[model samples]
Target: MTTKVLVAYGTTNGSTARIAETVAEVLDKEGLTAEALPARTVTSVWSYDAVVVGGALYTGRWHRDARRFVRRHREDLAARPVWLFSSGPLDPSASERDIPPVPGVVRAMARLDAQGHITFGGCLQEGARGRVARMILRSGKGGDFRDFARIEDWARTIAADLTADVRAGWL
Candidate 1:
């Protein structure tokens, strides 16, 4: 059977969802079966061989749905090869450097024993929710900062890691 991967994400303003989709697309191109779904909609992770959980960062905290998803499916996630990602920096810092996970994500990584984690640049365009988001947009701080090339590169790394595991009889 092909290795199936679930790319679950918690996004605000729909930007992180696009990032999740990109990841799934890259994995699919790399000969893996992958699907991108909203974290709140995924009732179970047991059907997949691996998972990639992503969340939007807001004020240094991960999206609530992503945190809840990890908490709700902790046991199943622990048994699988899991990776995590956060996308929330409005600047180019994420693409320019290694932005570490927020405290909550760090804890989740430890609990799930996730294979790896990455932080991607975030996007905040027009019509974003929340008063703060609106303010940021009005102040001209909101823009699409997500780097698709970087996102794809990360997904390729994941595919390589999974492929390696399969060849070594580890997955």
Candidate 2:
């Protein structure tokens, strides 16, 4: 059977969902069966051979749905090859440098023994929900900072690692 992967994400403005979809697309192209879904909609991770969890950073905190998903599926996640990602920084910093995961993500990484974690540039455009988002937009700070090339490169790396493990019978 093909290795089935789940790319689950929590997003307030939908930027993170797009990232997750990109990841799933890459994984599928790499010969793995993958799908992207909203974190809150998933009831379990058992059917997936591996999982990639992503969250949007808000006010220095990971998105609530992602946090809850990890907390709820810790056991299943720890048993498989899992990865984590966070999309937040409203600037080009994420693309320019390797931004570390937030504290909560770091802790979850340890607990779930995630294979890897990455921080990608965030996107905040007009019509984004929340007062802070509107305020940021009014302040002339809202823009799409996500680097698709970087995101694709990261997804490719993950595909390589997972495919290698599969060949070695580790997945």
Candidate 3:
């Protein structure tokens, strides 16, 4: 049987959306039916067999909509397999450090019984916003630091887990 997967994301400068799309592509290639949609578009979790929800980080927090999405769908998400991802931390130096996951993300994970959570680097457009926004953008130490290969590998792992569940008649 085919598994329907929803790859939903919240983005600011759009890096998170790209990450979600890449994950959806990987899942599709793995023979799962997957679609990447904005978090706001997901009205209900009942339509999907599995869900991958992602968001961009700002001021060390996840986008508000993504947090709200998790809070709103916590019960339905707990009844199904779910994964979470955050796109931020453009600083390569910080990549090796173990910062605690964003607070909203932590709550979502606990509430949803999320299968996994991953954090990836994000980008910033030059001179796009004001001083504070620019400062935060600069502090992340600007760069298109996303590792597509790693992202694809993670997607494959998620697909493998879901596929195993399907074969076992547990999905």
Candidate 4:
């Protein structure tokens, strides 16, 4: 049987969904059955062998829908392999480590003992931000900072992980 993976995400301005699509594409190319879907549409994570949850951060927090999805699936997620990714750091100077996901997201990952958690650069559209946020971004931190190569590499790692787990009968 094929290993199945779900790449669900909550995105603002569609950046994170693109990231999720890339992840799912890599997983499928690596021989896993995977699909990317919005977090709001994913009623549960129980059907998949593994789950990858991605979200965009705003105001030092993950999108509300992503948090709710994690919370709703907390029990099932705890029993299976789970990976988390956040796309948020717009500042090229800001390291991935400097951006933090909301506390609820952290708690969910901790509870699930998530296999991996990654952070990637995010993109912003014009007028997407409010006054204060725009001010902060205008300080030479604004632009499309997403790195597709890096994102693809991470997805490949996830593919390897899922493949190994399935082959070893760990799933």
- Cα lDDT computed for each candidate against the true fold: 0.95, 0.95, 0.86, 0.84
The C-alpha local distance difference test score for the whole of candidate 3 amounts to 0.86
lDDT of 1 by residue, 1-171 (tens): 588999999987899999999999999999999999999999999899999999999999999999999999999999999999999999999999999999999999999999999999999998899999999999999988899999999999999999999999888
Answer with 3 or 4, whichever has the higher lDDT. Answer: 3
lDDT of 1: 0.95
How many Å off is the CA of 134 in candidate 3?
2.9
| Candidate 2, superposed: residue stretches over 4 Å from native | none
- State each candidate's clash count: 0, 0, 0, 0
- Candidate 3 residue-wise lDDT, 31-144, digit = tens: 999999999878998989999999988888898778878888888889999999988877653255444578888888888889989888776767645576588657765678
**Total clashes for model 2:** 0
User: Taking the tens digit of each residue's C-alpha lDDT, what string does model 4 give over 1-171?
Assistant: 898899999986788999999999999999999999999999878789999999888888888878888888888888889999998887653344454556767887788899878788988867665675577567756678888888899999999988888789898
Provide the lowest-lDDT 10-residue window in model 1.
162-171
lDDT of 2 by residue, 35-71 (tens): 9999999999999999999999998889999999999
lDDT score, residue 164, model 1?
92
Ranking by lDDT: 1, 2, 3, 4
**Which predicted model would earn the best lDDT?**
1
Residue 100 of model 3: what lDDT? 59
Task: List residue ranges in candidate 4 displaced over 4 A.
Answer: 93-102, 127-141
